[model samples]
Target: MKQQKGFTLIELAIVLAIIGIILGAILKGQELINNAKAKRLLNDVKGWATLEYTFYDRYGRFAGDGDGDGLIDAGAFATSQANFGANYIPPTSALLTPTTAYQNSDFDAPVATLEAAQLLPAAQNAPQRRTNVTNAFNGITYPASVYIDNVGTFNVIAVKNIPCFAAKVIDSNIDGSIGANVGYVREIDNTGALTGNNTWSCDANNNEQQLVSLVYFFDKRPN
Candidate 1:
């Protein structure tokens, strides 16, 4: 009877090496994608701040902050997971004829105000931004709701539903600290309340859990 030969030792070693190289490439590609996502989150925060300031400069008041109280009086984001639903676009009329103010203001007013004035590009609309990021576990997209509350002692533009891992990357880049509970950038509960300056989980392994909404405080003009 002829003996059957399995994979030769050298052939097996070469195959294993090729497999390792392929896996390394895949992981590296994923890392780059994650890094790009983190950059987008950071840029969105900065760009939103710039928009608020630019609106303040042009109109002498912040958009969505109709009361001149220097806070974004978001009617939509009055509570957790409030209006500005996944597809909520402020009226086309509002978009086309936006004033520095609105009759019934909400998160919509800010984007509407800026859009009408041509300060914000059409791409900056809520629906567009809402799709930019997502809840990692369930794949739900979180809109970048412009609002202010007791996210801290000051006002903030609530960047919602950032998974813990990305949040850590962003917080570290902005605040120079690695935790989620303090700094101009804070990790807030889904209820949109600040529980005070303390640490929260930055578990490297919690990559897909939409752990918190990050509120970055801004110097909205004082009343």
Candidate 2:
């Protein structure tokens, strides 16, 4: 058999350099994507809060607070109306009172509630639990949600289903620091607790990659 000559140092170095460049580009691309997701998640929370507040500004009430209890709630506190009447008032619509029923047919009434009040254009009812923006990971599309939640002692509109990494970035960006239970933007575990409590999903663990919720206070803080 004829002996084969080994590759020159320059050729080997060129191959290694190309590999480094490809790896660097991939890492940079992933970082950029993560940043983009964080930004979109931030915008999602702000947009939902704005929509609810805009409804408040226009109708003096939240989109899903059928009882006008100053909260956007579901289940026992969710709107009980299959369809609102023409005379429905957003702020004080006693016609649609709260009742107990998990996953009521009208569970996703926030969007419809807004449309019924002429805030949003009347269209096909949105799928259950969809907010202003959706985040997709592992090929599963996650629609972030807005509802009444608390941070410490203050109630706020919580935006849910944000990736932990993205939530951290968002919290830092909003509050100028990262934290679990303090600041304008705070983290909430899947259990709806003010503190993450080192839960696998919102805190440290294998499930840390799981999604969590973030609450934006709109600068509403207790004195």
Which pairs clash (backbone N, Cα, C closer than 3 Å) in model 2?
A: none
For all candidates in order, the CA lDDT equals 0.57, 0.52
What tens-digit string does per-residue lDDT give for candidate 1 at 1-223? 9999899899999999999999999999997887787777777777777877887787676666655656555434333333443344543444432243543434555665566567655434455534433333222222233333533335566666666667777678878987566677776665556544466544535445446666776663112
Clashing pairs in 1: none
lDDT of 2 by residue, 1-223 (tens): 9999999999999999999999999999988987887787666556656776787777665666665656554322122122222222232233234441213233345555655665555544332223222343321111123333452333355555657887777677777887766677766554445563322244556454577665666626432
How many angstroms is residue 147 displaced in model 2 relative to the true structure, after the best TM-score fit?
A: 11
Candidate 2: lDDT of 197?
Answer: 39
Q: Global CA lDDT of candidate 2, please?
A: 0.52
**Which one is best on TM-score?**
1
Worst ten in a row by lDDT for model 1: 135-144
Q: Estimate each model's TM-score.
A: 0.73, 0.67
> What does the lDDT come to for candidate 1?
0.57
